[model samples]
Target: MMRGLPAFFAVLLAALLVSPTSARAEGPLVLAAASLQDVMVALADDWAARGCERPVLSFAGTQAIARQAAAGAPADIFISADRQWMDYLQKGDHLQADSRHILARNRLVIVAGEDGAWLGDPAAFLNAVEGRPLAVADTESVPAGRYAKAALTKMGVWNRVEGDLARTENVRAALALVERGAAPYGIVYQTDARASKAVRIAGRFAPRAHAPIVYPAALLKTASHEDAAPFLDFLTSPRAQAIFRRYGFAPAANDR
Candidate 1:
C-alpha cells in the first residue's frame, strides 16, 4: 500500500509539471515606490487578465527599495518614483541598462479632508495651516517629501511651515493623516488625491514648483532575460500607458 501511494504521487507530480497552465508560469517580483499603489496594482491585474502570470508587487519608499537592490535582494524589476533611485541602482550595476524606461510623469498637490480649509496661493496656504500640523512624506528620504519640500521652498513658504511639518514614511501615509482628519493639510502626488474619496484637492503646485516628478522602470540584474522581458515591454506599451492615464498619470513624453 505504501509503494502504491508513492507511485501515485509521482504520477500526479509529473502531470502537474506538464500542465499547460504551469508550463507558461512566470513569477517576476517587482519592487516599486509607494505612490504607485493604485495604478501598479491595476496594471498587474490587467497583465494577469491577458494571460501572463501576475508579477509580485512590493511597494515602499524608493530609497528603501534602492537599498534592497544594492543589497542584492531577489527582485526582478524596480520602478522608482524618482530618477535618482534608478540612477543609484544603475550605478551599482543592479539594473539592466537597456531596459530602463521612463514610464510616467506626475505633479504635486495639496489635499485636505472634507471639512479642511481650501488652499489658495502659497502664503495664504501657509496661513490657512498655521499652528496646525501639515502632513508630508519624509523629506530626507522620500521622493514625494523631497518634492514637497522643493515646492514649498519654491513658493517661499518652507521656512515658515518647517516647524509645523508632520512627516510620514511615505505619501500615502501623509494622505491618510489628512483623510482621518489628523492633519488639516497634506502634500502628495496629484494621482494620490485622485484615488482617495476621503480627501479633495485644495490646490496644485505649478509645473515649476519643483523638479519634474518622473517614474522610471528597469529590469533588475538578477532577473532572467526570459522572465523579465515581457513585463518590461508591457510597461511602456500603449495598453499599459492607457492604464496609467486612467489613473491620472501623464505618459512619459518619450514613452514611444
Candidate 2:
C-alpha cells in the first residue's frame, strides 16, 4: 500500500509537469538595435507575462541588422537606430514599404569620464588635450558618427579636430572609449550616456549642430512569423512608448 501511494503521487507529479497550460507557452520574437537593449529587455519581460511569448532579442548595429535582413536572416522585425539603414533595406527591396515606421528620436550629448573636467563650451571641444584623445564613431557607416561629423563641421571645427579623432565602429564603441578613459570625450546619444555610471555629460551641443535624430522600426518583407503584427503593435503601444520615454527617447513625431 505504501509503495502504491508513492507511485500514484509520482504519476500525478509527472502529469502536472507536462500540463497543457505549460505546453502552450511560447517564446518572444525580436531583432533590435544594440542601443535599445536595456529598455527592450524590460519591455519584453512585461509582454511575456501578459501571455505574449518572451522575445528573443538580437542586438547589433542598425546597419548590420539591415544587412542581415537583406541577406535573408530569419528575423521577424528590424529596429534601426536611423532611417537611412532601414531605407537602405527598402531601397534594396528587402523590406515592404508598408511595414516601415519611425519609432523614436534621440539627442546627442558630449560625454567625458566621471573624473574628467567639464567642457565649458563647444568651441573648447575642438582643441587638443595633452593626454586625452577624442573618440567618435566612424562616419562612413555608423549613423551616430556621420551625425557627429556633420555637427562638428557645422561648428567649423571638423578640420581642426579631425587629427585627434579616434574612430570607432559604432556609437557604443565610441562611448566605451570615453568610459574606459581610452579617450577623454565622446559624442553619443543622451540615453547611452545615461546608461553608464562611468561617464558624465560635459555639455549638450546646440540642437543645430546636427540634423534631428530619429529611430525607425520595421517588419522585413521576408519575416516568417505571422505573429509579427501583434509584436509590432505592442512596440508602438503606450506601454512601450512609456518605456522609451523613461529611457530618454523622445516621442516620435508620428505618434500623434
Candidate 3:
C-alpha cells in the first residue's frame, strides 16, 4: 500500500504540471486613474467575455497610483490620467518603455446638479459661482485638480475662488460632493459627468484652458502575469477603442 501511494502522488503532480495554462493563470492587476472607472470596468468585462482572465482593476488618483508604482507595488499595469505621472514612472524605471502606449485623451468640464443654463464665458461662470464652495480634487497632487486649477487660472479666477474651494481626494469624490449638494458645483473630467445621472455638465473648459488631458497605459517592469502584455494590447484594440469612444474619450492619435 505504501509503495502504491508514492506512485499515485507522482501521477497527480504530473497531471497538475500539464494542466492548461489558463487554468493556472490569474488576471492581470491594473492600477488605473479614478476617472476611468466606467470604461475600464466595461472593458475588463469584455475581456473576460472573450475567455481571457478578467483583469483586476484598481482605481485611484494618478499621483496615488504613481506613488504605489514607485514603491514597487506588484501590479501588472498602470494607466495614468495624464502624461506627467506616466513620465514620472518611466523616469523612475518602473515601467516597460516599449510597452508604453497613449490610450486616449479627455476634456475638462465644470459640473453642477442644478438644471439652469448659464451661457457665459468661464470668467462669468466663476463669477456666478462665487461664494459657493466649488468641489474639486486636490489641485496640488491630483491630475484632475491640477487641470482644474490651470483652467481657472487661465480664466483669471483662481485667486478669487481659491478660498471657497472644496477639495476632495479624487475627481469622483468631488462629483459626489456636488451630487449630494455638499457643493453646488464641481470640476471633473467630461467622462465623469457623463457617467453620473446626478449631475450635468454646466460648462466645458476651452482646449487651451490647461495642458492636454492624456491617458497613457503601460506594463510595470515587475509585472509577471502571463496576461499582462495581452491585456495592455487589448486596451488599444478596435473593440476597446470603441468602448472608450462610447465613454467620451478621444483617440490617442488626437493628442499628437
Candidate 4:
C-alpha cells in the first residue's frame, strides 16, 4: 500500500484544493514552473526551518501556471521559466508590478540516453539520430521547447528534425522521455539534466542560439497571504541564489 503521496503530487493536490473563498493555511501558495521542482522544494524547506510556514507549491508548464493566474487562481506567487509567461500575467494585471524581478537563469542542453559520441557535430548528430524521435516540450507554447526550436533552427537543423519530434507538455516531461529511453534524445534545461542520473548531457546550445533563459517571479495581484511578499523576497536572497547555483542554475542577470 502507498504510505504517503509523493512530494510533487502532494503539493499539487494542495494547490488544487485551494479556492478564493476557502480558508487558506498560513503559508503562501506558489505556482511555479515544472523545471523548478527540486530547487523550489529545498527553498521551501529552508524557509520552514526558519519558523515560517512552508509555501504550498504547484508545478506545471509556465503556460498552465500563467493561465491559472489569468483565471484568478488564489495562489499568492508565480514563478515562470521564461519571461514570456510572466509578461503574459503582468499584461493581464494578474501580478504586482513592483514585486516582479528576475529570479534565476539556466542553460539549454541536449540529453541522450544511449551511449555514444554522436553529438560532437550538429550535422553528424542529426544523421546519427536519423529516425529516432527527439523529445521536446511543446514548441508553440512551452518555453523549453521554444528555446530548443530556436537552437535547432539556428544550427540549421530544425527542418530536418521537425518530422522526428516527440513533444511533451513541459520541459520535465521531455527530460523524462529521454531518461526512460522512450525517446533516444531530448532537449531540456541544463538543470534538468543535472537532476537525473538516467540521462547524460550530450551537448549544450550556445546562449546566442536562443533568448536568454530567464526565470522571473512576482507576487500575484490577488495575493492575500501575509507570507507572500516575504517568500518572494526570500527567493531572490543570496542564500536562495546559492541554492539555485548548487542546482546548476545561474544567477539571474539584470535582464529587464
True-structure lDDT of candidate 4: 0.87
Q: Clash number for every model?
A: 0, 2, 0, 0
Higher-TM-score candidate among 2 and 4? 4
Q: How many backbone clashes does candidate 2 have?
A: 2
Tell me the TM-score of model 2: 0.84
Task: Please give the RMSD of candidate 3 to the true structure.
Answer: 9.9
Alpha-carbon runs more than 4 Å astray in model 1: 1-26
Better of 3 and 4 by TM-score: 4
> lDDT per residue, candidate 3, 71-122, as tens digits?
6667789999988899899889999868888898999988888763552586
Error of 2 at 112 (Å): 0.4
Taking all chains together, the TM-score of candidate 3 against the true structure is 0.87
Q: Answer with 2 or 3, whichever has the higher TM-score.
A: 3
On residues 135-231, what C-alpha lDDT tens digit does candidate 2 reach at each position? 8887778788888888778877777777778888778888999988889888888889999999999877676788778878787776666668677
lDDT of model 3, residue 4: 63
Error of 2 at 250 (Å): 0.8
What does the lDDT read for residue 136 in candidate 4?
98
Per-residue alpha-carbon lDDT of model 4 for 1-256, expressed as tens digits? 2543364455455576644422444588899999999999899889989999878778889998887777667789999999898888888888887888898999998899758444867887787666889999999999999999999999989988899999999999999998888898889999999999998988889999999999999999989999999999899999999999999999977655
Scored by TM-score, the top model is 4
Error of 4 at 98 (Å): 1.1
lDDT of 1 by residue, 1-256 (tens): 6766665555334423532444554557778898998898898888889877877677778887777667666678899998888888888899876888989999999999887667778767977877889999999889999999998999888888899999998899999999999998999999999999999999889979788899999998878536577887898999999999999999887841
